[model samples]
Target: MSTSIRVIEAVKSVNVQGSPAHWANEQGTRFKNPWTSWREHDWRDMYYILFKHNRLTPKAPENMSTLLPTRKPTWNHEGDDAQKLKATWIGHASFFVELPARANTEGRVPKRGARILFDPIFSTHCAPIKLAGTARITPPACALEELPEVDAVVISHNHYDHLDRPTLTKLAALPRKPHFFAPLGNLAQLMSVGVPQDNCHVLDWWQSRRVEVDIPSQDGSDKTVPAVFDLTCTPNQHGEGRTPMDRMGYPKSLWASWVAREVLPDLSSTSPKTVYFAGDTGYRAVLDEQNEDEGPVCEAFKQIGEKFGPIDLALLPIGAYAPRRFMSTVHCSPKDSALVFKDIKAKRAIAMHWGAFILTTEPIMEPPKKLKEACEEVGIEEGAFICTDIGQTMLYD
Candidate 1:
């Protein structure tokens, strides 16, 4: 078989080295987390912190119903309406997004728009096994059966919390199988779960692909128009692995943020909407022994903002960052997410990866609370950074 390699930002080339190997920088070093040292002492310290400082228990019972209203999502399958964009939070890092197609006045119904799912996890537990893993503290916003037919699914990495096999298996069996997009080393995992190889699209940081969907006119006419969107695998400061069967596999099946932008056929028109999905990341300086002044995490976001930003909506993580010494290198706090929102120049931002799981020491609601304070401190408008209920759908025109 041919080897798989990708060059990111024209600076790093990562090679997939099979099950035992992970994607690495040009110099063959695995991706490194800023402010984190994975030495033996660091491992011991993390365990000590996890046991002593972390609050693994939820404040309330997990069976409690969500306060957010749950609704049957209405999906525009064709590219019939150009003005509509809707997103629903399923819990944690999962989001159901609907992108509108160009409006067709001649058809009786709007054309089928594109439906995209990001980091979907519908399993009862976000762990390796249902009986011996981290059980969800709250129920999913919508049942799998309630989900609309999806056109594509984007995975951020191969961590058990983000890449639940049960959910992927269920998705694979759907009548209308959605294409799966993942980082370089993830295709094998998806294929192992029975997802057809043809449906998988693997990319590396800065790599992009264009997807075209057909939209029908509203008047029930036979006319169909095509809507194209670009999906880019962007960078995030995180690591990946499902278990310790092999080495830590930190950079295996690379972790990433994703950017989706509409590609209008007309060159003269203003750029279409752009959405930034920060799968999971930390806001910290990338410590370089050689160059202490270089902040990899901060610089990556700034570069993203400069390249493909003025983002319309930014979905950012705002939890799992307690006892900063341990989690800060992998997860972002509410304040950190606020900085990311600013860095990306997002018009509006939503807080996710909290309220659904008790993964850290902070109270369940602390992220939203801190997010509000952070945004206010940064002079962001009152409603600029919002948190929705698990099942709530936010529409942007």
Candidate 2:
């Protein structure tokens, strides 16, 4: 810890007695939304926007490179202060996170802590047919081949924007393929993308796995030693499906937020540093279930906070929420994101799911701007929640 670095008072997490059973039913045929009875909008709803509220679609920013600035990842892969954790925003809900490494580091190549990737989708377009899909407006942090050895890869859900088959296939083909994790009912999809069944983890909410990876020995020996990390599938308010059949009120597959915790020498103890990813979610039922803007906030985040409070860092969505009456049921507005940061009790947070693809009607730069307003409205400390350049790497102690 650096003397100059200030942090919020640590909030101890209260233990949760049992796994939340509201996530997926025993039959697994359908998933439930415990918070609200959501009414799914059909193509007919689009007519409402077209005929009644025809707002011109926002254009991509001309100075995107400057407005949504970026820099090549600058942290040394191996010698980076192990006590300092690094997060690289890989554009739009995609991030590469390295847990705090063991005190000492040793390697010719960059070797950070157990490296983990979240919702990595590097395609030019986020759709089944690339040519006719939403094109990526900003470039990814780095080329897929340039990423270092990854220990684990977690997908927030099966949305085309979050889960790209080609990208996963390429990663799975790497010599040192990573362990792939997703919410329940996604094992077959991961395998279809070349992830070995032995390396894929499809978990229900609250389920956790202790995965181990090899890191170069601190003794400077060419040999390596094993390090462990815990990957937990936590609850989120979202839905998943790729095709028409996969959708119809109930979720066809589970979607989840993830929590990654570092394992210290004493594996029995809890992690000193934890990271939470709110893949994609709506904080409350609005527009769809409630006509009013204010609604009952989802209890999932509070439960998540109870189990993993005082989170070191959190990546939350602050984009794609436009036509609040329509999109508020699925995506989070910047204000909603601010509440999520509070609900999770994160020490620090970075804004994502914006400045990349134009998934909705908001202006390209609107999310970050709105987030600033939201944070101020909520009296969050300045710099506590920030937006980094698309490819920038932020370090925290």
| Model 1 lDDT per residue over 1-397, tens place | 1111121233222222223222456643355433232222276555766577534544644444553334555554334234567788898899988775554333233354567799999887877666532777667877888886777789988887788888999999987677888877788899988899878888767778777666455566565555567888877777776666534643555778998887665542545888899998877732214342234344567757877778988899999886565676678888888888988888888888986666777766678889999999878899988998777777776
Instruction: Encode model 2's per-residue lDDT on 100-139: one tens digit a residue.
Output: 7664333222145778899998898998876632788789
> What ranges in model 2 sit over 4 Å off?
1-25, 37-39, 42-46, 49-55, 75-80, 104-111, 267-271, 288-293
lDDT to native, each model: 0.71, 0.78
Q: Candidate 1: worst 10 consecutive residues by lDDT?
A: 1-10
Task: Give me candidate 1's TM-score against the actual structure.
Answer: 0.83
**Which segments of model 1 are wrong by more than 4 Å?**
1-30, 33-41, 53-57, 61-82, 104-110, 131-133, 246-250, 267-270, 285-297
Model 1's alpha-carbon lDDT is: 0.71
Candidate 2 residue 267 C-alpha distance from true site, Å:
9.6
Which is the leading candidate under lDDT? 2
